[model samples]
Target: MPAFALEAEQRKWCEELRTLAARELRPLADAGEEGRINRELLAALGELGLLGRLFAPDGRPASALDLCLLRESLAYSCTEAETALALQGLGAGPVALAGTDGQRARWLTEVTAGRAVAAFALSEPGAGSDAAALALDAEPDGKGAGHGWRLTGSKTWISNAPHADVFTVFARTVKGAGSRGVTAFLVPAGRPGLGGEPLEMLSPHPVGTVTFDGVPVTRDDLLGEVDGGFGVAMRTLNLFRPSVGAFATGMAQAALDAAVEHAGTRRAFGGTLRDLQSVSHQLAETATRVEAARLLVYAAAAAYDRGEPDIPRRAAMAKLLATETAQQAVDAAVQIHGAAALQRGHLLEHLYREVRAPRIYEGASEVQRSIIAKELYS
Candidate 1:
């Protein structure tokens, strides 16, 4: 809230997390989207406390400033794998922030500990930026005994869906349709009639369509109040959307790093590529952008962690800068590497795809601008 910056403890955690991810997770980063995540990788992150950051020290952020730093570091090493790890916190954040104690102990604890994976099921074929347009339904059963409702309808483009053991799902509870009718649910995986099919997207992290048909849910499973999840989900996004920006900063930094290395080593016209003002200037500009974006994301993340009042505007700016900078940085890296950069097995190629998805997810870049403008105008 008051110009948040890194502390020694946050810096220490970032150093340790980067070492672990660079050692264990970075090597497996570009195994194609299908092979991106696994139990071993999850376990590795859990052991390093990547997943535990939100819950490890009394269920608050381990460090207000480290959220962006850790995510940036992880993204630099491996964005896809790192994002899956990061979402464990974001995906389950509504529960961590507002769940019933029972719900917290049941789903939140396990997800933080990496014993299970958590997912967010909010996007649908018809609803994304217009979250209020959600069509998923949660209705009281005709013969309700203990269970309060049954959720039905489909959610698309869900991250961590295939392997996730539970989901923080948003569905309609009141008879009225739209986001106002929505309520968040702590839906357990392997429940009867719950769907876990996968979808083919440009950049992948086990995303797909989740069809909930008469899935039994108890009153305790409802996150926030009836038709109150609109506020709950928005609050959760306010906490995480900046981290998505941090993830972008990490990626763009990676691209800058790649560009630097390539420019220094590769030769052009009987001289090193680094001698080219064009090449050197691009790398310099990208480096500057990465640092600026990283700082913006951190400032927003810390403000959110501190319960700052103007978080929506700051968070929107953070997301906007980080996501857009990541795309430009990766493109610069590709330019430095020429044709080789776009080849398979190249990190930038994968990053090129990975960077695009963040803008679309959390909220589209255009939507973020709209949000910031609306708030500023108001």
Candidate 2:
């Protein structure tokens, strides 16, 4: 498949996703509270078979391109639904990659069914972008080799926290080893010494702090090899990065569409906003940028699917361009719409809140640039 254009069936699927998001998912999103898990919406995604698509029954995982398309289509109309779906994939992905058969048989099915909520607990108050700087300690139990470890420390800015049924937690197991010291544990919420509380945030998702006092995790709970959690995290990030760009592109496209419609109809100085060269020019520029960002996202996903080298550079470029373009497109859309766009319930207002976080999460824009530069020099 070409990076610039999707196949006919793919395009049709995207259209259907957009319609489903608008007609079915949007209402569920509206009925749910902000900064909390929406089980209903998640269940709906499962019922529609969207969540199940994240992992394949044939043991072949879904391609990065499929993830990109699913994310972009859902995001175009229902950012909340898109976020929920993405979070599920992020939280449960490590299990699919390196879990034991029993683990996979247990939690994965629940996750795909949306019966169990999952959270990826990686970032902490002191280590948001520097994942290797993680401070969460996984102290070995002196009981013996199979005795397991006790987790101690806190993970902040975690999505679906305080409510998720399970968490893929990264903790410093070999301290002072930088990225090499970490270990990934599949921690269940009902375990002793595990606790969390939600935090109010600018974006409309559940973000919070999860604390571990002496959270006991046996070897059975380990996702990957001990002291190899960083690689698992990176692998998960690599897969999801381009899909993040797809999400941003979806928002940009939505913003551009809104701007174009407003410019074509709303009366201005002497005529419609489209008659003014400044408004028309801004819309045109934004449209071009959005298309460029979308193409970059597609190209990156294609590279990942094809197992191409230099994926880090392309993924970073795609995320950087698409997220930045989304911010610009949203800001332009708001400007064209004037104060009406700022109205609390306006689509642009929702998108305005939605657009800023992508540049920070997954990987910040600065982080992406650093990744791109490092890959270039290497």
| Clash totals in order | 1, 0
Best by lDDT: 2
Clashes of 2: 0
lDDT of candidate 2 over 227-285, digit per residue (tens): 99999999888888999999999999998999899889998788999999999899989
Predicted structure 2, TM vs. truth: 0.98
User: Candidate 1, residues 268-336: lDDT per residue as tens digits?
Assistant: 898989999988888888888888888888888777767778888998999998899988999888988
Clashing pairs in 1: 132-179
TM-scores, in order shown?
0.93, 0.98
The list of candidate 2 runs beyond 4 A from truth reads 1-4, 58-60
Candidate 1 Cα errors over 4 Å, as ranges: 1-5, 27-37, 60-64, 143-147, 175-177
Candidate number achieving the greatest TM-score relative to the actual structure: 2
Error of 1 at 267 (Å): 1.0
lDDT of each: 0.80, 0.92
